[model samples]
Target: MRTYFLLCLSIVLAANALSDNLVQAADPAFTHGVASGDPDRESVLLWTRLVSPDSPELELTWELAKDPTMQTILKTGTATARQEHDYCVKVIAADLEPGTTYYYRFRQGNIVSPTGRTRTLPRTAEHIRIGVANCAKYTGGYYHAYDALADTDDLDVIIHLGDYIYENGATRPGDSYYPSFLATGRQHNPPHTCVTLQDYRTRYAQYHQDPELLKLHARYPMIAIWDDHEIAKIPMQKSPSGEPIYDAAWQQRFNDSLQAWHEWIPCRAKQGEVIYRDFQLGSLVNLLMVDTRVCCKSKVDKTEASLKDPNRHIVGDEQLAWLKNSMLTHQATWNIMGNQLLFASKGSDWSRWPGFPTDRNQVIDFLTEHPRINFLITTGNAHNPHHYVVREKESSNILLHEVLPGSISSGNNTEKSRSNPAKLKKLIRAQESNPDLLWYNNDAHGFIVLDLTTQRALVEWYFVTDIRQKQYQVYRAHKLVIDVR
Candidate 1:
């Protein structure tokens, strides 16, 4: 018994000594980890941040490898991490083979960043699987959905619709509606609502520090777009009365948010250009990501005159023209529209595409006319799962399918509905009013797994059992198949 006790004491002392050394050696460098995104056939964007408090600028080296060990280097280059860009570095690794997975890492001195894995879009693929997610509030719950997705090795890519980071502050200590106890214990870095560029950057940093999200980024390539929360609530650039709403300060705020987004997100867009771009996945999918917030018209009231206004547009003319051209010319098996707003016509919801009835009608008409085109619209910001069929107005024929993957960690509609029974009843009435709504669930938090082939596209909604707990099971809450061929 004495010998066993001494052995345990020695082991504990050794562990304590090792932990002390690790703590002493720990410095704030590469604090956010590494991420890769915006993958093309022969190129991918790599991102990393060097959090060097003592240095304003630091030279970093990045290498791309074909193996996880990084012994076989395919490409290497040097980048500078400056304080102006928040010490973030992004570089495009070009001239790579299509459909090939690559490993990447960043190094500065003896410190090495985490290795990230990314794959380019295939020139020809018989099938593709993508994970769709959005609306991850830092104070909402645990990022169990992201952890599950990281473990899901079959996913080719991740499509993030919007609300990647909420601008809201930490949840109050003792709020009944959003109790702090129910939160995942992750708080916003600023401890207040984000209003400045620094605040937004800090919020993003807090989100990036999440282990599950970091793991997801390290494993799969992500294509993301920002919704309202990244800038402001409601994202009203103009008032309802046709006056410019964003003042000079607010405009500056918007610009700062844009800069931070561009710096942090590995999007392949030049400065001052819009983020709406098209990606081709062999002959299987033509993914068109649209930016609906930046250049959108003012949010109008639900008046008939406002809805019928010819000038009101959801997607600006340039993006709309690009979308039309892509739709008309694409020969892929699936035309996937990665949108930020809810595409369905909610009776009085002026925040969505329904507010711009003219543009909405034009898109609907285009889809109706092109019956052979397999159109699939994946949208976010609803915080709940919504599967609906977009039908023609006159003939009531199905034009396409709209799939809304529930939020990653945001509060579900069920909780809100429970708090307000009348609102829930009204939502049910709205669903009943629309025959195009195939199914709707407002009580779950999860993501959608989209599997596509030459013949059809299958969408499976996976719901996390509990977001408050780190360990949770994802159950297939819903599944739908659309004949694409």
Candidate 2:
């Protein structure tokens, strides 16, 4: 425990002493820390970015060990961090044992990165625990939630739903919802909304400078998918022609943002930029990570005619079909959907699953007919915690459960409810308005933990008391136990 606190303190002090660009430290230093993710039974992806005062590219050796002391080395390899990849190195430590914990670190001469802990997927398991989180904007507040998650020792992996980094400037232009977004004494580097690759990379670097986020990354493997804010909310906008625009400029911007995402996020190499993937944790859990915001989504249309249109799909035909197929193929005690969009409706937000009524009904119908699948859809983007029940074909019989772990630090209704009586009334009225709302919390900064077993699954929400201060307390505010299994 003393060692843990010292490590965290060292990281925070190092972050506090960094320059504006978060660079110019040593000859070749690990400024952003180490992270590992996308683990299979045999391999897990390891990542770290090097900051140098002289060289644009540096060679470093990474070692994975069975113990924390780095005595029993399992895998050792050398990698070159080049300027093209923003000096980020991602390498797969293959031939690892299943369900085994490993420690990894990068070294260049005398410089050594902070040791990161990671675990590969289990070949056979009776239980598993995962942390779920989303919507952490650097300008919104401090990342105490991430620090709290780091303190959780039982987590095997963390699923970042989306909005990992908000691309909005200090002020989001004409959007009245966030006139001056930077209220927590934090600022975005580059001082504008991300557009080009450099802009996105700069934003990611700024977020990386947070000691809490860095500590969380080093402590646990993260499975992440991008939301609208990661790419500057591109899919939400439409041109004057009333049609979704995919012009040349948009394509370039998308490519740039995606490149930055790939550079920063540690994940297994797929065919393309596809992040919608599945992970099987022995026979206990099957995690279906789907992209509902970016890869295959259309502009949001709230009109009744478009809502129920069979052709208008928020998840698109290809991804929806893949989602259903993946569930069918990968059977486990719990089938958890890592959804980026809200599955339940919240006020007039048509961007939820309700926006595509036909597809939503189709998914529910498929789950209903199966009858054997114990399903849970985990989503975010609202920055609020929600618990909802979806019925079987709108019948009395329950079909599936949906949950939002709540946002890490993105701007939520806390200030609005505190300042305005009408907003507070609406928050109260919101729960009263919906019969499916089992629980709702509009004001909080936190993360969720999902524990899965053969008999039941427990989802617990942990909220921090304050994000304005680095030192705060975190408590388990709510818990939902799904015993349908």
Question: What are the candidates' C-alpha RMSDs?
Answer: 7.1, 3.7
TM-score of each: 0.91, 0.91
Put down candidate 1 lDDT per residue, 77-178, tens digits, no spaces: 999999899888999899999988888988898877777778899999888888998998878788888877766656778989989988887677454226
lDDT of 2 by residue, 334-395 (tens): 89999987776665657778777777887887887788889999988878888988766657
Q: What is the lDDT of candidate 1?
A: 0.80
The parts of candidate 1 lying over 4 Å away from their true place are: 1-28, 173-177, 180-183, 238-244
For residue 101, model 1's alpha carbon misses the true position, in angstroms, by: 0.7
RMSD of 2: 3.7
Off by over 4 Å in 2: 1-22, 171-184, 236-244, 269-272, 347-349, 416-420
- Model 1 worst lDDT run, 10 consecutive residues: 1-10
As for candidate 2, its clashing pairs are none
Worst 10 residues of 2 by lDDT: 1-10
Q: Each candidate: how many clashes?
A: 1, 0
Identify the candidate with maximal TM-score.
1
